[model samples]
Target chain A: MRNLLILIAKYGSTLLFLFLELVCFFLIINFNKSQGEIFLHSANLLSGKVNQQTQKISDFLRLEAENDSLLTENARLLETIINFRIHDQENNFEAFENKDSLAIYKFIPARICNKTTHLRNNYITLCSGKNDSIIEGMGVISNTGIVGIVNNVTDNYAQAITILHSQSRISAALKSSQYHGTLIWEGSEANKLSLITLPKYAEISVGDTIVTSGYSTVFPAGVPVGKVLNYSIDGGGDNYKVEVELFNNLNKLSYVYVINFPEKEEKEQVEISDGN
Target chain B: MGTKWIGLIIRLLIVVFLQVVICKRINLDYGILSFAHIFIYPVWIMIAPTKIPRPLLITIAFFIGLFVDMFYDSPGVHAAASVFSAYARSMILRFLEPDIGYDTDHPFNLNKVGILWFISYCGVFLLAHLFFYYSVEAFSFVFFYEIIMSTIISLLFSVFIMLIFILLSNPKY
Candidate 1:
């Protein structure tokens, strides 16, 4: 007992070192609480500012595509107004009838400020946030298709877990057959994601469209994910490893939309009750 | 030894700043060489006070590493590697002792301890430091051979940088 005590007293410094290291390890593991949130929030803000500056510099180059989308929107609006007017004219003869087919959804534009595709858990930052009602878990979509899911929100900015993240498991389905599979990133490729657990019998082919399964409230039904690039079989079953060519060229993504589900709170209550 | 402490602090601050503000933004993908990281921060362990309390030294090393980790968005890697080096610093010093004993508690300088001793000391420390760092960063031995190769290359680069810093400071050997 005396020898043990003497030994402890002699090597106390090493013991202290071990203790400090363990404490540091614990802190690092549980660093996700509030400090991480603050870092991500600030990073999002800074990245957003940089992206905005870059976008302004590059806006002149994308004018043609922006003009094309605007023209298409304008044509659709004109056609809707004309059709509504004609229907109202016809309905006037049938006494009282409501004839308004106004579009409900409006795109709240925000720029992609910061994004990463190489990390295990990738995330993106947008220029818009709570000031624009860009709450957590909102769907961020580009003009081409789905971009990511919002995971953090501050007063002036929001951060998103992009489709390229290894941890991003999005519910997606084949456009033709509607066979649902979980879309996952394989941690190495930026231009591809693995669509796993697909049954072999499903008549899948290259160039087939992939879209959101709408299993979650975050994204609406039928938001495009990517086109199927390839498939293969594994020992367990026919695991189709899809090379998803993302719609939003993540490298070039500048603008996106933050979507809000009006019935989100009600849905959450229902989900909680269901769980219980 | 006093100047060494000042130099370590200054270099650490510069590395953290450069890594966070500069290197974090400069990722060039070269296939197998995926990312070329320049780690000049371990100069702290390379020049720390030889006789400081081991626990306090480890704690100081941990915080310095943790600060770097915080800025770079990678958790635990720098901290783990730095603590390992801090723990091994005294051992390396003990091993590199020549026929004449190091009388002072200060670090063995190039002039006092000879160039070969300093080189071997720096090499061993760099090897241990890089071994822990890359192993932790990779998190798997599947790329066992790759890890070994990367570790050697990284150590060589780190040693080159350390030599540059030591030369620039022109510390009284």
Candidate 2:
């Protein structure tokens, strides 16, 4: 009894240090996707309002550039309108309507509040939540390409685990061959992530476009992920680990969109059953 | 002694305020040296009364760090740094046992310990503190060169400023 007591006393601080370290590790390991949902969502709403207010100021300051973009878009649209009238009764009209719907799905705007890119596990907050009809597992995007997925939601705010996070895994495919694989963050750089598990038989090339596979219901089909930067065959030459340079610069992220799939729950259920 | 405590509290409040409000605004992002933030809160850890109980000292250190973390938007870096400093302090005190005494009844003084002993005391622990703090932040040795460079620069700057505070104070003890 005395020896046991002495031993415990002897190693108390060491034990404490180990315990604290374990606590920190546990916090790191179990940094849940759900706990941050409320704070991030609220922050998103507040930041969204703030961003909207500041945008007016920025718009006023950059009126010339804004006008230039508007003018260019106006010119393009005017040309399209003229072309449309010229081809009013033509075959391309059907094609144009289809393209319009595709372009319409390109944006699902949200406001950012609490965002961090430097950490191993990075996350972003947005101002669209459950009440906004935002749901967990919705695809998030920007003007460029896929940014993240809606991980959780509160009444008025939503949080996204960005592609930069080590915990993030997305289904991706080669734009050319439609070969699908897993995409993961390398944790070395903010801008780069990796697409893994491509079969050696699949033809891949440098600068080949990578996009969301639409394999998972989170992101819709054919959203641009990045261009293939580098790749190498595994030791057995069975698969390729390819580097993907993300289109949405994780560092310069500001506004994003939460893509709401109306049939998400049903789709996920189907996927789960199929997996089983 | 009462006046000293009041002065210390006032200085601590100012340090915390400036660290959050002003130092954060100074955005100096050189490769490894954000010179502005290098020693912002370490000053508090350096000046805390040595006589305070170890666990309480560590708790205060942890909260002070957490407070800095809240403002800086970093979750745990400062808290971890401060706690480690508190943990290692007694060992540092053991190593740098002053020949006479630390004037416990009065207040801490640099002159009493002399410049060399003071420097030795701060130098050893400050380096250890910085090493652990930076390692936790970097989280890996891949940025080994960068971490070392930052550590050296930050430690030097922090120690310099710490000495300045100590010398300027000219404590009666």
Candidate 3:
């Protein structure tokens, strides 16, 4: 018993060290599964914030290059969308192209340099001009819907009259019944335009989609105009004045495409002497 | 005797602070070595009075390493490393002892030993400590290459830092 006591006294601290290490191993193995995750997350949060602060320096240096890449990516996506539309039309027998007819519409991509939606005669200036084959009477549209018709052109830039202009008129129709009408904007509202000349017999309802009629050589047919919000009939009760919510918001304009209908000029030249 | 313990406690606090606060945040990753961790806390156990009981020294080493593990967010690894180091310390001390041997209450310190002898003593212990630390941290033999590289690189840095601390403070424990 005395020898055992002496040994206990001699090796007590070593036992304690072994015991504490066992506890540490227990904590490391067990808590590491659950609490350790939270602990590491909090620690990483501290270090992550420090990294973010330092990363800001490198991020600022790469900002211009990043912006250039993002813009190029956006352009590529837009081009892909245009190609998909062309492919879709090729497969669609009803909307199939006729090479002998007028001319195929080619989209010329352009960025909006300036726009004014508050004015009675709102105009949108595009980056593309006469140099890019953009001419007066060419129609402009965005990813959303029809935007405006080309009104003037310079060597480097072109100005188009927006759909919100009071004088600007577009031929559109009810998608379901094919009842055609003229889309005109009142001077008061920017986004809300009225579809006039829609026959009363036409199947018109709230939320009915209005699309360009393809009757005019400017705007293509089936370009989404907007949904029907409300409509009224005149005293004659023959035509509908449809309050339409436009898809293209001029205030949010960025990139736009000018659609060139090649047959327009030749057909118009054969009829009238207007070179547009 | 009590003053010796007081000095030890003070050194413990300073070493722990240096380990947890300052050394923890150093962005030391370079080359194939993942971390250049400089552990100065093991020096607290290394330079204790040669006459102290081996078990007591080992226990203290365990606690010091456990304390560091709490802050490092990796429990058990430092404790395992420190305890191993402390156990190995007794053998190394016995091997490196002078013919005259050590006197009770007279601890090894920079003032007591020649600089070259002290540096070699610190280098051997720190290398072992760092090797065990990285080995336990990796927790797998798959990181054999990593463990060796980290241990070698960290040993160089840790020993240099330990030497600098000894040279500057030159603590008498």
Candidate 4:
């Protein structure tokens, strides 16, 4: 027993290293499999707080740029409102009948407290959550284009799976031909996305605009998504895979709009009945 | 003795602050340079007093790495690399032993060890740290090419930064 103690005393460092490394590998594997939820959550919360403090200083410095962008967005929203008013006047007889369509999507503005763009699966944290009427599965968009969908929420903060995430599959269509496709990230460049399942015969070209299809209750119809960068025939040779360049830079996002679709529950209930 | 411990703690705080708050934010992703990440945190373990017990040194390295990983949003990749390099440090010091030998209480400061020896020592450990870091980060041999490329590129930048830091501080302890 004394000899064993001597041996341990001599090789204590090596033994400790082996043990520590074993623990580290355990963490790596478990975290990769997403089974380290408690660790990840607490880590995120702590880091989120540090990032929030840093973000405040940078946010103060970028106030002028933020104001300029907000002004342009305000002007664009005002123009849309004006157009709606004109359409309502033109269809005055039908306007009263379809009033629900006029206010289908309500936008809840939130600031991005923290985000990451380089990871295979990226997530964004917003400064608003359940207390602010934000909920899981609500679609998020910046002033420019689609940001992500809300995945988790606390009392005051929420997490979103950005479009850059591998599992993010947004329904999109060509603005010109209206050919439907699934938008997905290929885990390479930050700004590029792939639109798959587009029919081979669809009229597609470089610079063709892509927009939300409104098939899902998340995003409204005709929201700007991206522009086609290139296209190729899928391995199956039955569909066209078009590379899309997003309008939103994503890396520089500061503020976003969480889409609130009030009729989502009603639509989902109807779909469930149909399935039954 | 108490002062020495206090000095070490202060240096630890400074190094951690520099790595987590400053170096973490510096994106060197200009065209074709995306793979080069700056990591000087390993210098903390490298510059520690030579007489520190191996078990204690390894433990310090592990916790510091885990602290950095929290900010990077990666759980264990950094800790694994740091531990590996910390384990390898003693072997490296033995290999690079000078004719006069080491003063166990003092750190291998640039002035004490001379430029050539200090550079080689830092370079070798930085390379080991970064290689292990990228390998564990990829977590698969399928990305062998990516792992190699990132290690070499990051090594160059990290070594350069280490040289500048050593030259500036030239700490005796």
The residue ranges of model 1 lying beyond 4 angstroms of the native Cα positions read A1-8, A27-276, B1-8, B18-35, B103-106, B171-173
Candidate with better DockQ, 2 vs 3 = 3
Q: DockQ values for all predictions?
A: 0.14, 0.04, 0.20, 0.26
Please, what are the lDDT tens digits per residue for candidate 4 over residues B1-173?
Answer: 89878877877888788888988887877765788888988988988887788999999999999998888888888999999999999999888899999876564866677889888898899988999999888766667988998898888888888788767766667
- Per-residue accuracy of model 1 over A1-276 as CA lDDT, tens digit each: 999889778886677667766765565545634434544666688999999989987887887678657744643443343234434544443222222333222345677778886677778898788998778877777767777899999998899998887677788888789888888888766767778877677789999988877667776557787898887874676666666777667777776766666666787789989994
- Best DockQ goes to which candidate? 4
Cα lDDT tens digits, model 3, B63-131, are 888899899877787988898888789778777776677544454755565677787888888888888
Evaluate model 1 with DockQ and give the value. 0.14
Q: Which ten contiguous residues of candidate 2 chain A have the minimum total lDDT? A: A27-36
True contacts kept of 4: 0.64
Report the CA-based lDDT of candidate 4 relative to the real structure.
0.85
Q: Which pairs clash in the backbone of model 3?
A: none
Looking at model 1, how many pairs of residues clash? 0
lDDT of 1 by residue, B1-173 (tens): 58766766676677667657775665436764553456677776677656667777888888888888898666776887888888888887788767778857545566776667777878999888888877766555665777787788766666776777666754432
Model 4 segments more than 4 A misplaced: A33-276, B105-107
